[model samples]
Target: MAAREILADFPAGGPRGSWPAEEKAAELTRQGQPATVRMDLASDRFLVVPVGERS
Candidate 1:
């Protein structure tokens, strides 16, 4: 898959209607990677994964 990142002040999880925060975290972990943060434009909230935990 293509590595896509937000250029705006977006968070880490995933894009809107793209993927769930928890699901992204799981996917990253499954891929031997880790997640960091997430931004919900609709909710105007940020989802942050703790260090060494989610990412």
Candidate 2:
């Protein structure tokens, strides 16, 4: 399978924490697509990506 692409990046804070990423991932999953949250190289950012099928 092809590697997933980053859909968005969310910064850690009082409002834009990992919640948005999580919500987006969940929405994708509900639509039969797999999604994931990953930390950037510096470990200071959250990235949401589509992982194709659930498998």
Best by TM-score: 2
Given candidate 2, what's the lDDT at residue 37?
74
Model 1 stretches with alpha carbons more than 4 Å out: 1-19, 36-50, 53-55
Off by over 4 Å in 2: 1-4, 14-18, 52-55
**TM-scores, all models, native as reference:** 0.34, 0.62
Q: lDDT (0-100) at residue 1 of candidate 2?
A: 65
> What is every candidate's alpha-carbon RMSD to the true fold?
9.2, 4.6
**Which 10 consecutive positions of candidate 2 have the poorest summed lDDT?**
9-18
lDDT of 2 by residue, 1-55 (tens): 6554787777755383339878878887898878887766565777877774231
Over the stretch 1-51, how does candidate 1's per-residue lDDT look in tens digits? Answer: 444353123344456676455665666666766555555567674553533
| lDDT to native, each model | 0.50, 0.71
Model 1 — TM-score against the truth? 0.34
